[model samples]
Target: MKWVTYDAGSGPRTGILDGPTVRGLGAGVTLLSLLGDDGERLAEAGAAARTAPTEVRPLDEVRLLAPIPRPPSIRDGLCFLDHLRGCYRAMGRGGELHPAWSQTPAFYFGNPAAVVGPYDDVPIAPGCELFDFELEIGAVIGRGGRDLHPDTAEEHIVGYTFYNDWTARDHQLRDMAQGIGMGKAKDSAITLGPALVTADELEPYRSDGRLHLEVSATVNGREVSRGTLAAMDWTFGELLAYLSRGTDLLPGDVIGSGTVPGGCLLEHVDTPDMAGFSGWLRPGDVVSLQGPALGHTRQTVRPAPPMIPLRTGC
Candidate 1:
């Protein structure tokens, strides 16, 4: 079942998206609430909620929010080969690409509270010339446990969703230059959702030919980045296993599988060799991503305040 978090005339509520309608999930509003419980309980609750008479609303009419407005924890991994290669090449160290990254999933914390939904306005900070978009797949955790084995990692994932890890490259590079961690107040980079597709529902798509999902990003109507899910070096299971090693995996925790090759303008634009690449995403740009049965979302970029100087002497 496709679950969504949306605002009806009454307020925010969790619902099952059916065709063009959404059936409310009682007072248990927000998808995070359902995710807070284990998958079994979620399944039971969802079954019951379906049969109850609900104020079904037009899916397009209701205001859509991120499936989980505030994920309990957000851990993103840089485990994609395309992204790795692109980053290394940008640093003039293309030969330094590590094929053994599957053994060590590099990750960073993201702001869970900053997530916006499908058609939401992605505010672009002013005085920034390096707006970018990253097409990624995010795994939603359904249970809490530690030291999970890669073999059993699938058990911990309840579903998956599409994410656009939007970024401001100028500010990001500034932080990178100082040798500071990547999470330097980049609280606004994360965006995702149309709805969450359960693991069982998308399992068939995980296999070879069927796993072919196209990801494309557009600035205005022109395409900037395009790639396939098949390009990922490490499977989602490997990332789960690697992450659960030293930490407890809790319900509602989101793990973004980094970005695919050619997933953003930074991959091509930053290089003088690719000088002809057009301008990066800017205000009024509309970025969209679409997959086979997973649906798509178009978000308009809005102008935002300039990036504040990094605070020190705290």
Candidate 2:
């Protein structure tokens, strides 16, 4: 079942996406609450809602929001070796990936408060010159767990959604020199949604223990990058196990698959492939991502507000 959170003038409500229509599951129910809903009650309720005509609306008429607007937490992992390889190439660092990358998936927490709706305008990071978007998949946790095993981690995932891990390349690079955190480089925006598709809905695209869906991205109506989720060297299950080693993963938590290979402009910036185009995202630039089952979304890049001056600069 594909789920959505939308507002139809009144307020935000949980809904089931059925083709051209969005069937609102009524008041008091939120996508966050549904993540922890046990038994067959949700299914039965969704079934019942489909037959009723009370809150159903055309998909184009309602305002869509991220399935779990403000996730409890966001864990983004470097699961795709291609993205790593691309980064290495862009940075002129000639070496194979770290041995630990093959043994365990490493991840960083993102700001949940930075999340925005699919169609929301994404502002360029303040004080950043190289704004970019990362195309990837995000798995939403349905059940909370600790020290989970990789083999059984899939059971805890409720659904998957298209994730845009927006970044500020210059800020990230500068912060790397400090050997510190990402700072505000990735704190600006993270777009999610259109619809959260459950596992069963994406069954047709699953292969080799990973999703083989056709993923493509474009900026300003020009094709920037394209690839499949199967390009990932690590699996979400493995990522879950490593990330949950000592920490608890709660319902409403989102696990990002990092950026897919060739999924972001930073990877193509200095490359011959994107040579003619400016790699950084600019104001009024429209960025889009698409995949089968998982819905598509387009967001226009808006200008960043004036940069806040640092009084105590180093």
Candidate 3:
């Protein structure tokens, strides 16, 4: 069944997606509360929510937070070959370091506090010249384990959700060249939600033609980058297995499956013919992603809160 983390009257809540309707779980219905336990608890919660006859809310009324809003931690995997290729081409770079694109997934930690609701505003950092957005799929871990075999990786997954790995290419390129990544790729750079669809419900999407995924990002109602899910080089299963090796996997952890090819501004480098294509995003730009089954969410770019200025005394 499809699961969602939503806002009830008081705070965040967890529920099952019954068509466009949402059926909330028992008291204390946050997804983290459910997935933080063994798989048995999750199943029990699902059953309870299914038969409880809860009030069904329109998908838009209640805000949709990241599946695991404050997941113990997040490790986004760089396993999509098409995205890697385009990234390199845009930068005039060369072959990938990982030949098979199967090496340990290159991942990074995202800010837990900045986790956004389905239709939240995304800050566009001032002075960032090349702002870009990516459409990705994030997998939520259900069980904790270490050195998990490839075949058993899926068992640990609880569900899937849409991700907008919003990026600032200018900062990223500068930091990467220095062998470090910090302000360039942290906190608030990621956007996720709408709801999490349990793993069992997403199995059908794994088939060749069934995935038929398409991602489109529009700026102020004009289309920019667009791509299909069929182009991903590595499947989610492979990335999970590779990451689990020799490392402890925990519940409520998120694994972001990088961006899709041509899914951002970096790919349209110095092209005049690409009208309405501007690399840098200014405040007031509205970005949105739409997929087949996953509903669409929009983020309006706004100025970030002012930072405290540093003072010095001689």
Candidate 4:
């Protein structure tokens, strides 16, 4: 079932998206609250919601929010080999996979508080000129577990949503040059949602132990990049198992499937045509990331607030 957290005339509330109408799941029932239990219960609730007589509203009448506005934690895994290779090449490093990449999934923790809804405006970071967006899919945790075996990892996932890991590429490259981590470079706003498609609803897209979904990104209504989820070098189950090792995976935690191959401008900016562009993203640009199973997230780029002066001498 497709689940959405939206705000109508009142406030944010959970609902099931049936066709073009939203069937309210009652007040105070946020997506995070529904995720706090097994997917079976959530599915049951959705079944009831579909058949129950309730106040229904046009989908366009309500504003959609990130399925889990405040997820417990956000971890993004670098599971696509091609994306990594392209990123390294973009940074002037050779496009070769590191030996460690084949051994395990590499990931970074993202700021949960920086998350914005699908239709929200993303402020370009102050002093950032090379802004970019990573097109990815996010798996939301349904049940908590520790040291979960790879074979059992799929059981922990509840649903999926489209994710945009917005980045300030200039800051990211500078930090890498100085051997600093991605803390500040990636702490900016990340976007998720439109709606979360539960795992059961995605059965048709599963094949060869991987999801067969096309992922794409469009800027200003023009397609910029495209790739398929089947190209991921590491499966979500493997990433989840690796993440659960010695750590408890909590409900509402989000695990991203990294950027897909050719999913971001960073990998293509060096091309002759793309290099002519002055800024990576400008005010009024609309970026939309879409997947067949997971709904699309559309964000409008907005100018950043004026920089706050930093204190100099002590």
Q: What would you estimate as the lDDT of candidate 3?
A: 0.72
The C-alpha RMSD in Å for every predicted model, in order, reads 3.1, 1.6, 3.1, 1.9
Query: Where does model 3 exceed 4 Å of error?
Result: 36-38, 53-55, 94-104, 208-212, 307-314
Compute each candidate's TM-score over C-alphas. Answer: 0.89, 0.95, 0.87, 0.95
Instruction: List the candidate 4 regions with Cα displacement exceeding 4 Å.
Output: 177-180, 272-279, 312-314
Question: Positional deviation of 284 in candidate 1, in angstroms?
Answer: 0.6
Lowest-scoring 10 consecutive residues by lDDT in candidate 3? 305-314
Residue 300 C-alpha lDDT in model 2: 95
* Residue-by-residue lDDT tens digits, candidate 2, 1-314: 88888998898888898889998877878778766654255576667668873488999999999988999999899899878888888889854787888888878889999999999999899888989899988999888888999888878888899999999998898878887777778899999998888877787898778778787888877887788877778788888988898989998899999898888987887877785786688898999998766879999999999886778562
lDDT of 1: 0.75
Q: Pick the candidate with the highest lDDT.
A: 4
Model 4, position 191, has a per-residue lDDT of 90
Question: Tens-digit lDDT track for model 3 on 139-240?
Answer: 889888787777667678887777887777766766777886555555556777777777676566666523455667777777766766566566566677
TM-score of 3: 0.87
Residue clash pairs of candidate 3:
14-29
How many Å off is the CA of 304 in candidate 3? Answer: 3.1
lDDT of each: 0.75, 0.85, 0.72, 0.86
Per-residue lDDT tens digits for candidate 1, residues 1-314, read: 77888897777888878889887777655566666555776787678657773667888789987788788888888767768777667657763655467557787888877788888988874456777788887889987778888777868888878888888777687778887677543667587788887877776666653345666766666666677666667666777888888889888899998897767777776666445545677677788877765677789888877655557621
